[model samples]
Target: MSVLVVGASAAGLTTAEALRRKGFRDPITVLGAEYHRPYDRPPLSKQFLLGDWDETRTRLRPDTMLTALDAEFVLGDPAVALDGHTVHTTSGRSLTADHVVIATGLTPRRLPGPDLEGVHVLRTLDDAAALRRSLTPEVQVVVVGDGVLGAEIAATVCKLGLSVTLAGPQAALMEAQLGAVVGGLLGELHTAAGVELRLGVAVDGLTGVGGRVSGVRLANGDLLPADVVVVALGAAPATGWLEGSGLTVENGVVCDEYCRAADGVYAAGDVARWRAEDRLVRLENRTNATEQALCVAANILGERQPYRPIPYFWTDQFSTRLQVHGRPSADLTIAEGNIGERFVAHYRDAGRIVGVLGWNAPKQTRAHRQHLVRT
Candidate 1:
């Protein structure tokens, strides 16, 4: 049997490798839109952008390791459409397989404006490299988002000695995930690190000069001067190719508990929205990408395993390492603590712990994760 994986990033690569590890030695083909090999994304906005790490360091696996999988890699050609069991690529190649795995991941949301020179979105390796090249000590950067990506970019650029302004419509940074209390603390952290926080502001458009982005125009008619603008406005699933493919496509490709989208078709990673608890969630983190890929591979191998994931994410900014495990809710009763100088917050839903957030407290946070797992 032939298996086709549409996407060559972390989720797709892991799925292909896991299939081999699970003793499925049938013909395997991996298709990637990008020409480069699969690389780690988390470092793109942090160490990679800061010049602390090179492009080679971002690779998920070395060439030698990937060669051992013995899968046919079709790079620089994206699957443009899906018809029955045949996948059509943008290069006009049609390949048929017994089973298909969709892991297209996400595409960054672009701002409504003409493509300016200094405006960038940090989702791909090339995007990070371009933004890094534009960064300078004298350059003033305005990041128009307060989410994790926006916050990380702002922090990285600030550490590079560039003046940065973080503007977003949210009342507090990461208010949806970390809650206002912890989110406000993060705002303080960014402010203390020389990042100007412009919260609760609506951006109208971008102002340009000589065909280059100059500043961010606010709805209230104020323009924030910017030498560079990074739009970390989140991303949308790259599932346009799956249109009319007889699969449920909501915000992402809706899948069953086993990550099955349709007969002989499965999905994993940021592109797969699976049933979790009573709701459907599409996780876009490195941990979920790897975990879901393995689960999908297992299910494909007839293990009949359900993808029950305990969501985990981490971020590094300045001198703080923020780690979180489990689903965090704003209404959860929080128990706060301080280990040495590190701050830790345990979120409890009812009497059972639902989530744990730690600021530079990895060990304690992991210990709390075990409790969450038991319950």
Candidate 2:
């Protein structure tokens, strides 16, 4: 059976590779919105932004590997709309397939404000390159968001010895994701790394002069001056083109447990929000991208397996590297090591371990993951 993948990033590429490995020798077409071939996105915030890695070094696959897949890659042309198993591109090209997979990923959310030169958001390679050219050790930078993307950008900028202020509504860094104890500790870490914290306030809007952003205005009538401003306010799923495609689209493209949105049509990665037993769930991490695609590929080949994976994510800031398995909560206790050093924190619910976090202690975290395996 012929297949069409409406994304060229991690999930889309993984799905094609999985399908090939599963012995499906049908024709495959991979569509990409960006001009660049599939590249790793995690490094865009840290390594690429810091100039530690160049553009070619960030590619997810080499030319030789892509050639071996033998799939036609239509780059620089974005899928503008979908009708059944047919996808229409911006170049007015229409292609139909027996099976269609949507792995369109996400688009970064921008703050609503006037058009300014210094304002930026990082989602694709072009965004990172544009932001990098403005970043210098001398310029005052302001990152508006307290989540993972904002925190990572702030940490990387501070490492360059640049003046940066993290503005957000959370009392501590990543409070919603890391909880009170770990989030408070992360706040201290950023402080130790020379990043100025402007927390507990909502951002009003952007203030600028001569069409260039000058500072970020907060709800409290305080303005934080900035020469370069990075808006890392998270992202939304890229499902706008599927609006009238007869697919259930809410926060994302809703699907069943098998990742099928409709017969002969499925979704994976950040774009796919599927039912997992009781509630609808969607994961935006790299691990889920691969796992969900694999499950989708298997189901497409008639295995009919459900996609139910325990969410996992990690982040590095300053000298600390954190790894989390399953869902962690604020009710945490020391499972191994100590708070001031490399330690493992266990999050329990109803006296049962639900998640495990390793603060610079990777081995201990894996050992504790067994406790949450049955969860």
Candidate 3:
């Protein structure tokens, strides 16, 4: 029962470890494109970007620890092909296994702009390092997008003594993920941090001089002068290499409730789009990465386990900690509080509670999640 895992990220590593722990003593191989060891990505925009943490501190398992798991390591080579039970790598290497797990994760979505020197997108370690080097008090940063990644980069750059202006196409920042009520609250936080918030605007194009970005023009004829432009528009699944692999690929690789794909193949993490109750869902967070990987490992060992749970996600911007419980929809109603110091918002679907968003109120949110099952 040999297993081959594509990607050495959180999902891949967790699946490998879970398989080993389940007593499947078959040969296992982990392939990664990154030469560096498997490292944590959550801190790349927060601590690592601000110089509060080092690259060595973000690793989930160092090289020595990964070797102890008794899995074959193939670093610096990306899996370029998936044919039945075999994987072909970019380094001219081929691997055959009884089972394969695709946990390729995601890549940043690039925007149309002039080829400039001081532009960046924070997804990997190299992106963070390059962006950090350009972070100084003298740099004026124009951050494109207001999602979690964009907000974090904006907050970090502001904390680093750089002027920042956050631009987003939506009326409210992070409105798609965090409903308008919470999005409005976050807007206030960014304002408090001295981050210029520009919403409901679209970038016309980028203007540069001497191969360096100078400023961005808006459709409204307004221009934002920036020394550094960081595009944090969000991410798409890194499944381009799997083209024509006979897998159902939408926004991600579609899988079943057990995380199984076609012909002994499985997928987890940001790359796996599995069936939920009403729809096929793909979560690009660590919680889903770990949980889905565990379920995949168990099913591979003939345990016949099914992955089912409420979706969860969290974000931190300065002192504000926003936590979301359960899957939410765009039409969900929001309940607000006075003063807005601490608020608890409920997301209802068909007159039943489906999600809850909390700010400085964990006890209420915890109780709410517990009651969801009972109600």
Q: lDDT tens string, model 3, 165-184?
A: 99988878798887787788
The most accurate candidate by lDDT is 2
For each candidate, give its TM-score against the true structure: 0.96, 0.98, 0.95
Number of the top TM-score candidate = 2
Stretches off by above 4 angstroms in model 3 are 330-339, 373-375
Which residue pairs of candidate 3 clash? none
What shift in Å separates residue 125 of candidate 1 from its native position after superposition?
0.3
Poorest stretch of ten by lDDT in candidate 3: 330-339
lDDT of 2 by residue, 1-375 (tens): 899999999999999999999999989999999999999888999899988999999999999999999899999999999998999999999989999999999999989977899899999999999999999668999999999999999999998889999999999898988798998999999999899999999998999999999999999999999999999898999999997899999999999999999999999999999998888998889889999999999999999998878778888887789999988887899999989799999898888888889999988888988888522
Q: Candidate 3: what lDDT? A: 0.85
User: Please, what is the whole-model Cα lDDT of each candidate in the order they appear?
Assistant: 0.89, 0.92, 0.85
Q: Report lDDT (Cα) of residue 147, candidate 3.
A: 88
Query: What are the runs in model 1 whose C-alpha is more than 4 Å off?
Result: 332-336, 373-375
Candidate 3: count of backbone clashes, pairs at least 3 residues apart or interchain: 0
